[model samples]
Target: MNIKSIILGVLFLFMSGQIALAQSTGTEREITELSKKKWEWMADKNADSLAELFHDKAKFVHMGGTWGKDREVDIIRSGGIHYKKAEIHEVMVEVMGETAILWNRITLLAVVGGNEVSNPFMVTEVYVKQNDTWKLGDLTFSKLLTRD
Candidate 1:
């Protein structure tokens, strides 16, 4: 290829990469905001909104056990496990194409089995973009020793 053509090709590739990076940044921000909203919904026990946000095949892992979407919604709706509040200390997100992974550190106040408890945890949330909307695919909570 001539020098001019080579230079143009390189410029085009560079611009494409820039655009992709920008899109990924935007996706990350969107996922972060969604995660915040999800916490609010969980605390409020808004099963309807949570149902819409969670994928059909979504799974949840807690200190006790792992379960599917329906069981999780049932627990929230029935007040078997209530997420009273979450004090988010930090959050970080990574977007990979259509999937995003979010890491959150927080102190959580929850009521389980008629008793209220507080604990610190590292929460991992995985979301997948399907049909232009992000849906929760997996969530796992790792209990932390210190409640700093």
Candidate 2:
């Protein structure tokens, strides 16, 4: 092979690799957007929409304690913990192809039994891609600050 031709072929392969890498990065951004959408539905009290985001075997560990899917549904229905508005202040996503871990800080304006409350929370959520859908595999919350 001519030296110049070989050089040109190597350059082409390198550029192709870069394109694949860029597409992979874009897919990660899409996963982060999914997390954002799910949180928005949660803040809106759209439990049905949020439900669609959860994995069937999802587990939740709240700041208070552990709870299963049934308890979570009940809490939403009974207004045990209701978010009037929840804003995500910071978000970090660690993606491993088909799975991701999301961490974020939220400023929550919540209503508990007709009383208004505010809190700063650190939340961790796991998402797994299944059948082209990202589902919440786990949710855990830690209270950074609480105001009565």
Candidate 3:
């Protein structure tokens, strides 16, 4: 190819890559904000809002055990495991088509069985888009040895 043609091709590729990057960045921001909101809702024990966000078949994996959406909502509503606060240190998000996976490194203050405690955790959240709305499909918390 001629020098001119090569430069034109390179420019086109650059523009295409930029467009893709912009789209992904937008998605990342949206998912990150939604995750932040979810944490707030959990701390506030807003089961109604959480119920709306969680998918019908959503699963929750805690350090104690795994459960489905309804049970999870009940736990929140009843203050069975009160989420007092989540101090997020870092978040990473990835989008694949209509699905997004978010990872959060956090120190969580919670009341479990009437005992207040704090722990460092790496939390994973999975979201899927259906009918133009994002629903949480999974949430899992893995305890960390150190806060980092």
Better of 2 and 3 by lDDT: 3
Give the range where candidate 2 is weakest over 10 consecutive residues by summed lDDT.
Answer: 69-78
Q: How many residue pairs clash in each candidate?
A: 0, 0, 0
RMSD of each: 1.4, 3.1, 1.4
Residue by residue across 78-132, what tens digits does model 1's lDDT show?
Answer: 9999999989999999988888999999999999999999999999999998999
**Regions more than 4 Å wrong, model 3:** 1-6
* Candidate 1: pairs in clash: none
In angstroms, the error of model 2 at 12 is 5.8
Task: Write one digit per residue (lDDT tens) for candidate 3, span 22-94.
Answer: 9999999999999999999999999999999999999999999999999999999999999999999999999
**Highest-scoring model, lDDT:** 3
Deviation (Å) of 95 in candidate 2: 0.9
Stretch of 10 with least lDDT, candidate 3: 139-148
**Local distance difference test, candidate 3:** 0.97
Which one wins by lDDT: 1 or 3? 3
